[model samples]
Target: MKEKLSRKLAQNVEALKDIFQDSSDLVYRDIQFTESRRGLIVYVEGIINVDLVDQNIISPLIEGLVKAEKPVERLSELPFTRISLTQTSTASDWPGVIEAILTAHVVIFMDDSDEVLTFDVKGGSRRSVQEPSTETVIRGPREGFTESLRINTALLRFKLKTEKLKMKPLIVGKITKTDVVVSYIDGLAKQDLVDSVLDRLKQIDMDGILESGYVEEWIEDNPYSPFPQMQYSERPDTIAAQLLEGKVAIFVDGTPFVLVAPVTLWQLLQSSEDYYERYFVTNFIRWIRLFFLLVALMLPGLYIAVTTYHQDMLPSSLILSIATAREAIPFPAIIEALIMEVSFEALQEAGIRLPKTIGQAVSILGALVIGQAAVQAGIVSAPIVIVVSMTGIASFTLPRFNLATTVRMLRFLIMILAALFGLFGIVVGTVWILVHLTQLKSFGVPYLLGVSPYRLRDFKDIFVRVPMWKMSQRPNSSSETNRNRIGAPKLRGRADEHEGW
Candidate 1:
């Protein structure tokens, strides 16, 4: 069987050779021993660590006793070799060789044996774990996950430090063979949720999955929706908290962002820093964030409605001021607002795409020049410009860029609706949004848990974050069991101590 397998492998090698013909980095070597035995070693150059292979396998086997007439006998007798050597009874084959080489493992074959010896030599260039620039916190650990799968998994292990923490590996993407790990706490997490996540992942049959975002889009319940169904974070502490609460985390190789399932709309408004701060301060900040969120999504639409259809909504003094500002403008209220919004978005995109040294200055200069030029030329009203500016500022208060973009896109839709039917259209749009959100599910959990369904047990950490001591249980929506996170403290008075004395 070993001999037959080796012959088959040899035939497949010609096919693999043709497949990798244009590749300058692929290394192939055909070895012939003194006894007329045949074999081959194939690997990609830079991806595989050459030094370790040379020291561990190649140097000893080729330069030492294995280089002689009875190389197979010599290798079998060698006691100092660290590798678990095997003998193949079949012929060394091509597909097996290609698979092993691509994985950064060294494959060795010998004449008259069917088994191929595979040595693990995975060391190569990889980025070191560093602080996450996008999700920085002053009080927590600065270290963030690297692109390497092993390193990312190690970071999680360091935080969890328990056997209950489970990481199930999956191979996604038919061509890319990208590795994805689904992590969760076993006992704390619901079994059905885990099974659902796994089932969804298995259903994905894409050609490639380069990042967690791809998986998120593929497995999401509502792909057409503007809102993000999965929450992404580079912070391990954030992931740890979610995992403890029974939310499954998906870590894709080669990307820093990790995807957490069953996230609520309110969760997108939260920051990891909220838990680190005092309860009262955190609650105030949460409310402030919620206010900004509404302003970001609705300010432009509200302005359009009031200026075009609901002029009576404004006070007499404010109405006069608005009228004076618009008198010199050449365009209608809708066009004026749209122009400013589009210009602001263009400036933002330019700032991001430009070089860091000049981007900030360019954005600032662009905003100043455009605003001043528009005011002087009477192309747009001064009050409209102010509203757009305030709206831009409010959008920045959102922590997640994906969610910010969602708000920006939806703001325009609301604006159109408001223009058509006034405040009634705005209310109708709001109802549509809420209906979609209420129907959406992240994994198997409702997206509007604590607010829509009104679960009192989960309220402590949602809209208004309570102190750490007061939050004695994990989020109820996240886990069906193991909700307790802290134990109750027994009070001891001074009188009780005196009586004991």
Candidate 2:
């Protein structure tokens, strides 16, 4: 019934009703263009800009047709220039017409004509752009991506106002038909990489894409791996930076978070603030983050192994202190650590799921109370409580939550290994994780691009924040042919003085 539009206005309205059954938001307004000529306007109520339709579409047509001496069957015969609409198109089929309506376009059907004119008046209540909660920076633009797809693209365009910036739109999902835009700089990003991303996205067969994570799972290089292959950001500056660095960004409709692909593990540890701050400060912070990252992953297991089997490796004084603390505890070192770790993890989960007003208070108070009470009850040792608390704190230093979660999960695995074989098990598990890291690929790009592949140029921005002038070339990991980001430093200051001398 919705395959084609009928010439009769009543029949077309009935077909629309059949398709949109029980949806009260679908509005139908019958209009008398002239005493003789008639038509109908159909649009979703809330999403449509009612003022634009009334002022531009309805007023122009009604007044123009009334003043005209002759009656016309087609609306194209009347002058449309009098209206203020900038975008107007004719859709002949029901699919195109219905899609346009769903995307906030007004559809006008004439009494005798088979075609419907769609006006793009996409205005509705939407969240205003606010500073991103995840990627906050002290020295950069505070604006972030909104839920509106067009607004997100416009934000990107405002950052990178180059003709080389390209946005290719694609529709996915059968039932919802969500809008997705693939954005990248034209010549900077590798053609093969772009094609691979497009191919993977086109193959997505899903009922609906509720968020960017949905698309990430389907199109990522490794779906089974616990590590996140694609990085997601709600900040426009972050997305713009990735695009300029020869990466592709997928912008999904109705989601503020956008996905950037071919991300490396080093990139996961980085924050937007790293680039915004001075090189020395950022370098110090980077090293600190790396230190905590290791602690977050191995602290608990190392503590367990040391206390249980590697006691001789510790100093006599420290061993005695730990022994004194665990004198009353009956559980083994592994069990003690597991109890505190599990309790801490539970508190963290509750904090996130609970309301914001009490979540932080609950997590902090719960950890303090549980740790103090457990120590008094002799159910767990004090040293184990300290280790678990340190591990949780270390995990918070990771900039990306997904990477933090990966660390959290792997911590338990390593803990199990430590429980069985002590220090030897910890070494074996760390090596296995390193091997997995080396093997992990994000869209065919090495996950450890600068570190494993040993590219010196890429390392300038990876492990340490080199001075902006020193980083003359973009990351070789991006596979850019024209990698020169800044030309050779000109003879401007000291060099100019030397030349004058």
TM-score of each: 0.90, 0.96
Model 2 — TM-score against the truth?
A: 0.96
Best by TM-score: 2
> Lowest lDDT 10-mer window, candidate 2?
489-498
lDDT of 1 by residue, 1-501 (tens): 122343344654565667677888887777654455566666678767788767766566566445344444422443225533242222145556556667666666544555565665766788888999778776778988878787888888888988999999998989888889999999888888788888999999989998888899888888998999999988888899788888888999889899988788888888888888877888898888889989988898899899899899899999999999999888877889889999999999999999999998999899989998998899998898888888989998887888999999998988889888889999999999999989888776788888778887777777787667767778876565687888884443348667866
lDDT against the true structure, each candidate: 0.79, 0.90
lDDT, candidate 2, 1-501, per-residue tens: 657788888888888888899999988888876676688889999887889888988788778777877776577876465888878899999999989999899998888788999899987888999998777777888999989999999999999999999999998898778999999998789999899989998999988988898899899887889999999999988998898788999999999999998899988999988888888999999999999999999999999999989899999999999999999999998889999999999999999999999999999999999999999999999988999999999999999999999999999999999999998999999999999999999988899998889899888888788888888877765655878888767533366566866
User: What are the runs in model 1 whose C-alpha is more than 4 Å off?
Assistant: 1-4, 7-16, 29-39, 60-70, 74-80, 83-93, 490-501
